[model samples]
Target: MNNHLSKTIKNEMFSHHYQLLYNLNDFKPFGVEILFRSSLFSNPQRAFQKAKELNKLYELETTSISKAITDIHLNSIQGQIPDHLFINVYPSTLIHDDFVKTMKNLIEQTSISASNIVFEINEEELITDHYSLHNAASNLKEEGFHIAVDDFGKGYGSIQTVIEIEPSYIKMDKFFADEIEYSTHKQEMLKSMVTYCEKIKSNIVLEGIETPEQFFKARELGIKLGQGFLLARPCPLEDL
Candidate 1:
């Protein structure tokens, strides 16, 4: 993968999950997107330790912070609660049969409706074989989970992955939002992507909308949903 940033700058990725809401005002509130950490592992030994600990607790094929999400959901079921949950899946692990089976069981046991679930795919890493990754995505789609291509326009496989996966949602990165104020080039790129997405039936969600100007700009571009500090920060489940 090409390092898009300077080597002097340290990059850190912390995985956190958030729910996606369609219509921003819908009662039933029908859609969700699970965000994942995009930065690569910093320490080999510590990463291994984290993975081993996660593997012991969850049925995921790999041990990583993402497993923490599955563990929480697997143990979250109790008396009456909402029947919706979205989880992240790394592109590298999407083809693991056991992991997928474990996910199916977790959703089933919790009685979570599949329609409200979304599998967010982070494209920071290049997918050498689009066919395999597309197949894995298609399998999850077959089971009724909405697909979302995360960090769109900020990764190596942005356009190709969008073409192949054909996710239900395309999340715009903060890079675009920050540049839209001064760059006609960025605005044109964004508008073209939105147009293509519409032609293919994909909804656009602008991530990292931090100011009123940003929000209105996205709205002007026909973006239906906007997420970021401007709208609402990620709150705890109880708070949400």
Candidate 2:
């Protein structure tokens, strides 16, 4: 499966984007997010059905997410990027020993530094089994790749996963970023979350900063790391 993803990602059709590091304040921490230009499975219904059938067979295949990450890493290395690159990964891949082994091997073979690579564990698919996640995170952390809990506030309506995993970075949902201007409640909530993040030595990144107002609001609230159309849009590595 890993081999399959590797081959598919090498296809020239796909392009990768690296999340930029914007400082919240000089004292604020910096970080990045990796996003795909398109959905991993373009056809959701078909993909789900195929995934279900694959599950019935209990077979492991390299996920599109993993392939995309690998692609981003290679791009970064070729471009000589120094910032950490975030890559989204599927839960099934996280639980697969073969995938883990392949990832470790790939890291060794690649020019990208393990410490500058981030694996983004999306909450929608991450909550199924507790033990598998724990072991997967532990294994990845031990290998020097940081973990980020993507879209933290919007999914599953709880912070149980965040508390449990204590990932290296937490990405605020677009909702929070949108609401930071009008609601004191939202502002306070973000402040508390940022405070908690500070205690754990993790950085908080405000996503969807598409406007000047959003950028100012995030900075005023101490969110140094940001992403949106205002600062810079995702581009080919060659452009950077």
Candidate 1 Cα deviation (angstroms), residue 184: 1.8
lDDT of 1 by residue, 1-240 (tens): 123211211232334445435443332434434444334545433332354344421322233333434544544564323343445555766765565665576567544556656666756556787888888888878888777877787877888888889998888878888846667887787788779888999887777777778767776777676667766665444434
Error at 152, model 2, angstroms: 0.7
Question: What are the root-mean-square deviations of the candidates from the true structure over C-alphas?
Answer: 7.7, 4.4
Taken over the whole model, the C-alpha lDDT of each candidate is 0.60, 0.66
Clash-forming residue pairs, model 2? 23-224, 24-224
After TM-score superposition, what is the CA distance of residue 208 in candidate 1 from its true location, in Å? 0.8
TM-score of each: 0.72, 0.79
The reply for model 2, stretches above 4 Å from the true place, is 1-13, 26-32, 38-79
Give the backbone clash total of model 2.
2
Candidate No. with top lDDT: 2
TM-score: model 1 vs. ground truth: 0.72
Off by over 4 Å in 1: 1-86
Model 1 lDDT, full chain set: 0.60
